[model samples]
Target: MEYYEVLENFGQLALACVLGGMIGYERQSRRKSAGLRTNILVCLGSCLIMMMSYEIYKQVEGMTNADPARLGAQVVSGIGFLGAGAIMKEGVSVTGLTTAACLWVVACVGLAVGAGFYIEAIMTTILVVIVVGVLSHFELKKSTRAGVLQLTVYSDNNPEQLSIITSCLDDLHIDITKIKMREEYARNEREQTIILVMEMMLLNSRHYSTTHIVNILQDLPGIHGIELR
Candidate 1:
């Protein structure tokens, strides 16, 4: 490549870094796991990979035609594994999914820059900023205060009832992290009573209160008592 062309693509790489940071800034503000630095590096790294790939496929004076897109395709495929590592499941809720998605897209932007598709790179950066930064807040608001509640109720002479209650919790997306049940008798009068102790965590991290959880538990049948701790 000529001096000027090389300079121009280098500049593209720089821009990709800035754009990646712009997208990552929003995630950092929202306390996401992958913050500004992580995103910026992802974008810049992708750009470098793409640029290297392009250079590799270039048919020089001694070499014949080579497929450049081959390298770019591999770049994307490689990024997929990295993105998958960022995704995780917590009980009934999933986290890092959006962050992982952003990372993957940032890689694409880098590849675009390497391929000299400056316009597409810039546009994609802006769109990512809007979607990951702006739209995430709204999505959080919509899901806030909305979650599945787990409940455990105790009853005497009906141990099978506990299974039914747990089943209902599952249907509502309320997964139990721990469960302990005991049978006790008072005054030796065959006062066998079931004692249920359980723990619950909302899959969605939103603005919620214990009362909201309590109310949901109250609505469940056979849940005479509920405790969230």
Candidate 2:
């Protein structure tokens, strides 16, 4: 290869590093298994393979039928194994799927850079960052806002009290997953008291703290005490 051609190829490789590193930085910031170094290596390797394929085709010219795409095509299929490694099943939820997808996309971006499709590679990197970085932020915010709560409410033996408590919970978008109630006689008081134990899930718990819930229930006519776990 001529000196200028080799310099151009090196330039392409450098671009691949930059594009891959952009994605890697996001993954690293989030503490993903495949972080900055892994993504950059994957992109750099794929780019080198594509460049080698092209060089091989040039050397053999018309000797036999040497296809530049043959080696590059293997990258697409071979990347699946690496992607699969990123996936994990934890209990009922599966994680790292997005990381696996990011690896695959990063490899493609590398191939584009190797093939001199600079615009395509840059654009793909931007879109992938938006999908994994920006979109993931919103997804995590929504998910973390939900939480489970266990509450024990002490109130007078009034049927209307239970109704009032549930009404308040409903207004706050709290779902009662499980509930138990029992009647008990107070040591100092002659009237019967109701002990309500409930397991609740909040759709947006961040909006309502445990103290806030307790304060709301304390204002009810029959409620005497509240405990939250």
Candidate 3:
């Protein structure tokens, strides 16, 4: 427990906090739930645990039972629970996976700092920031290939059917951009029919075809015909 040793350990903790905060800053700027304070605390706590493990190893010198890396191994696997907390499922769309992953990596960065792997820790922080910041736009652009789907539906004027259709669209992760409804009088049946035109943004359009959506809507009661434009 020399003064220099204490300084070194303190410096490592500081580095871990800084690196973790940088990653969290990116997430915070994007309005993510787990941001600055959360990341910093996780990193600092991990670093402290690792530092204690290292000190224990030094104290138990010449002992065959000591393992300096044992605590760090636990940190690696134990971080999963924290990461899982960051994930959220909304309808068919899942969010916060990237944030969870970032937290996991930040934990690793903290361990690296505690182990005196400064270079590796710094490099990993930079890479995480680049992936989270720069690559996200490209990923969004790539998924927009399917773009928007425009559809017109002919059905009976039933509010229940309309509710079912909207619910199905939400489950499909389809965002309704615009919707227009007009009433039509059927000459043969004397019943009122509804004509609905909708513009929707498909989240996973590659997996869902126009025909697939039409088939799904056809199953709902009161839907007579569906036309994809």
Q: Identify the leading candidate in terms of TM-score.
A: 3
lDDT per residue for candidate 3 within 102-137, as digits (tens), equals 888988999999988999999999999999999988
Where is the poorest 10-residue window by lDDT in model 1?
148-157
Error of 3 at 212 (Å): 13
- Give the Cα lDDT of each candidate: 0.70, 0.83, 0.81
Error of 3 at 204 (Å): 8.5
Model 1 off-target regions past 4 Å? 60-65, 143-225
lDDT of each residue in 1-229, candidate 1, tens digit only: 6999878887978988888888889889988888899888988988888887777776442465567777778878888788888887642346788889888898899888878888998899888888876786785665544543344444433655556655655565654443455544433357545444433444423434557646765776655566554
**lDDT: the better of candidates 1 and 2:** 2
In the range 20-114, model 2's lDDT, one tens digit per residue, is 99999999999999999999999999999998998899889996778998888999899999999999864223678899999999999999999
Can you give the TM-score per candidate against the true fold? 0.67, 0.64, 0.68
Alpha carbon lDDT of residue 210, candidate 2? Answer: 78
Q: List per-candidate RMSD values in Å.
A: 6.8, 9.9, 8.2
Determine the C-alpha RMSD for candidate 1 after optimal superposition of all C-alphas: 6.8
